[model samples]
Target: MSVEKPEGPGVIAEKLGAWIADVHASALPDRTVEIARLLLLDVTGLCIAGRGESYVRATLQATDPGGACTALGHAGSFSAFDAALINGTAAHGEDYDDTFEGGPVHSGAVVVPAVLAACEREGLGGEALLRGIAVGAELMCRLSLVAPRAIHSAGFHPTAVIGALAAAGGVAAALRLEARQTTSALGIAGSMAAGIIEYLAEGTSTKRMHAGWAAQSGIRAALMARGGFDGPRTVLEGKHGFFKAFAPSRAPDFSPVLETLGESWIMETIAFKPYACGTMTQPYIDCAIALAERGVQAEQIRDIVCEVGEGTVHRLWEELAVKHRPPTAYAAKFSTPFCMAVGFFDRKAGFGQFTEARIHDPAVLALAGKIRYVIDPDNEYPDNFTGHLRATLNDGTVQEVRQPHMRGGAREPLTGAELAQKFVDNAQHGGWNAALADEARGWCETVFGEPALGTIARFRQ
Candidate 1:
């Protein structure tokens, strides 16, 4: 008897393929292209500032010989896939990549590298790259929306998993694949999608590789589809498929995936991080900074009360002790108390503050020791990053501040100028020259006008 085939991953892939083939680069909306440019700027900044990181350096060394693609500060020559694996890892090393609320996926880390790799190999122009980025990001974000909570809570990292299919769609669109081929590529990409949240259990570099793996796997999937390979036709909806197998908690909504493809853009919902820590810790950091500014000295504070929403405490403060004293710099990025303490004392938390030296800083630790977190059952998590802080001084005076929505999120998106400044600051840390950095920024702005990506690919090297 023949085995009945599941069609979920395959069907979603097919529609995605059709979308890519039908959407012409020139037809993309002006606003979407502008959003793509912003994402590129943000990703480029992360890649630059994150280069000096040991994880980035180690990844570069492990995957050397990347051809024509830049790996931040390193000079190496490898295959296009290798370039994606290394550069993508570097971009996400600091967790400074862009985040999407509909889903927690990191778009730029996976999509940008894959598009750049395909553009380099095909000699595609900036317009195609921009369109591909937009399409890829949309697919990734929509997929995230399908079962946002279930997929995330099930211990899967959406950035590394759904992101592969998104990149595949983008590449297929850029290369002008037929609808059938595009669908097949998505099917193939589905089989390759995998990422776990186990990294949160410790500060392992495994998380860094998720984005790289997604980028490389998506590129390979697209290549296979281009070569006439057929993949499952219904990979998203069928029994034992992506939605069912990976996320069984809730039924996914497929409408968003096939919604007004060109008119409604998910890339517009992307949020760039202001802090180098986990997204969950951002609101707390803001609250701490505000409290410190109100003349609350670290020593004078008795018990620093944090009335956090249920979701933040459950996801971010699960292991309260660890959050109080993180063992490594990577672990520090996920520690709410550590991030909050640093923000309270410094008023800013950059890449430098998460270092081992800073993690062990007495002042920050002292401030952290005063923290007492109280979960507010009424406060909903994730719908929005809301936070509350109450500082009780030695004299028994309590001052409180509450933020409904974290800065730099959907409710408070960063301005173009603010994002550009972040990019420049991150690039300067990555060691890019003022002239070269300006040139890079310009290239990203008008990337659509260029005839081919040969220049940009060479720059990645």
Candidate 2:
């Protein structure tokens, strides 16, 4: 999943700052641009989809109103930072944002909000927005590859901490910051980064806020640097650098993050989640759904043991009783036992499946109670997500099912048509009418082609 040891020493922050300063919209490959557009669409849709969610409402309520930027579902404009905060939180509120498996981080959730908010505030065009999104989202993916699971291993959330750096890079790129300025922005971002996995213990909403906080933090850092605020240019590789503080267990390998720079795109492989739950839990949900498809009724199964990667146990499998009976819908999204059980019964784990009513369903809890996990030494996670289920039937018949990898991932990505449908569905769920949803879809198709980016006012309530 990660480059095990450090590559022969290199100045990371300075090199990355140079690349961010030089990357251009016109120089980007066609396929890469297409990926960026899809990501833009996906993140916008997720933001709209997550509106009205309790966590989103809390964010909106806590944030002061009145600024120059637009939030998808809200009627009025907001400050650029507040808009970024709300949009980013809403995008990830339902855990429906895009993910990359190479190291497992959500790119769109963090980057799109910060860059788009800045563009709206500055009246920047689609090209600038696109470039910013590319820099930010791609950085999130590449950064994940630096130390991989080490971040999670150290009890920190990768998306939350690394996302600040990615957001800073994206905002700096969008604003055309100089190399030194960009380096200082990244340096400032390193200290601003903060997120812990303590939210996992309960079904709390703190994790949802991580993306937004990071996004805004990035913007603040970038703007501060642009204003001549100096910070450590060696923030990334110094003794007290970001990696040492967050992913303390491993020596970071800079290859995945620095080797290609703008040459090859790691963000192209970004995975859209088919399910609305956790990234690692997606494959297992597939396995359970497949088991149901094979005519193995829930009643016929006595107990099922899932073979899972050692890395996943703490987050998804541990607290066995809690996994079986997740405290809230939010908690269920991370509980493999509950997710698989729900997926098996419902055949899907989308927005509809994550409701308070559905999460408390008697059948789902019963099936979840029957499911358990056994750590498989050979199982791959963070690198490649796979699933395996061995069910022991009441009649002594054992049925085994395995999912080779996560669907909607680089190995088997979701089609544009599917993503479009998902976008429309998410818009509808967020309270937009069909016509409004269709308008949003049309916007996604052509927004990047526009000479100037426009507001999503049509999608606003």
Candidate 3:
């Protein structure tokens, strides 16, 4: 069958492609490069930590392909595509990767794996890899802003939908493809973009795999374009384009995609997670931790009520009964009530807090059952993820706390020491010995200053 053409000419994809092709590491601002390095370090730790998850193990067993690229935690190497798929999955498996403040998409989980895999396969240097990552992240964040909440409203996961194109952009940069080739890659990626939000209903592992799948699709699209395959240049803004097909109810604003491409770096706004749960639930965890620090115990509380934004209700707060007693460990991460309860009882939320045993803890469940949310119409969401909490004591005393903004966002970024500790903690959690953990930490500390990613590719060793 012959494909129909988008009417007239399209400049959105062309502009993006030209920018990605021309940008290099030396041209990037110092802060942007530093953030990219930190993200790389953070995502590498997350991948290692996620390797032992049930879903990741199952995926590794099912697709045991061998090639030239390292798969992060695995002792063996795999094809660039398979490596990207597995590493991306590992990065996002625990929902601990960095999130773009604007799109809320897990940018590192998708872009990092694709860029790293391509760099490894092509023998590219660290500078090329870092530049590719920065470009890819900017594209993903901007694309998400084009339609705002349209993707989620249409029952699609923004990461999976927007990630494919972003991955293509990154991989194309890694390969140093020309503008025409990069544009073709992005156009091909549009056809590959797909991911439904159905995992929310059952709390399955499908959501964990979305980033990896998008990464694999992007590498394939970029490779196809390099091999002379042709695709539409208007895949993002033309008829039957990404937003038009995925979000029919909304009109996409194309300005974000091309406005201030070089002068402004959206990747700088990417936020690392303090908690292992959903992005929106991070601020609430802060509130719960604050309350716990104030000496509020589960036994001393009569009821816990949280005020949430209207936008978060459908995904995190609805189905009150189910949210209180989540069916699985993965499900509990998306359950605001469950996360709140865990935060209060443990005074922290991390990899250990999301285990199956902890999910069914009597004390946590008791507090979770008593938890409920009232929609705050004045709240900000899809812009700033904020949280508010209220606790009514058994003595008729009520205490309230509000997290004005997300902790790890641009307003309050993690310090260098904090980031280092996080990497060490993740390494320990992933079953690495003390020496290995320290070694990994040291490598990440100096990787940005190195000439090539030869050491990073061998991190599993």
Best by lDDT: 2
Computed on alpha carbons, the lDDT of every model, listed in order, comes to 0.79, 0.89, 0.86
Q: Tens digits of per-residue lDDT for model 1 on 1-461?
A: 97675545446666667667878767777777777888888887777777777787777667757365555445555676877787689788888788877577788899888887787777778877887788888888888878867876778887888888888888887777888888888888889999988887777888888888898898898899999997777777867677887788988888877787656787787888888878767888899889888877888888778877654554567687777887788988888888999998889888778888998998888888778788787776656677778888889898888877767877898888888888888888888877777887888887778887666643543
- Write candidate 3's Cα lDDT for 1-461 as tens digits: 98865544456888888888999888899888877888788888888888787888887875766777988878878888888889899899889889977677999899999998888888888778888888888889899899877788889999998999999999998789999999999999999998998898978999899999999899999999999998789888877788898877789988887778878998888999888999999999899889989988889898888878776787898788889999899999999999999998888889889989998899999989888989888877878988888999999999899998898899888888888888888877788877887777777667655677778655664
Candidate 1 residue spans exceeding 4 A from truth: 1-10, 64-68, 457-461
Clashing pairs in 3: none
Q: RMSDs, each prediction? A: 2.4, 3.9, 1.8
Model 2 backbone overlap count: 2
In candidate 2 the C-alpha lDDT for residue 457 amounts to: 50
| Candidate 3 lDDT | 0.86
C-alpha TM-score for every candidate:
0.93, 0.97, 0.96
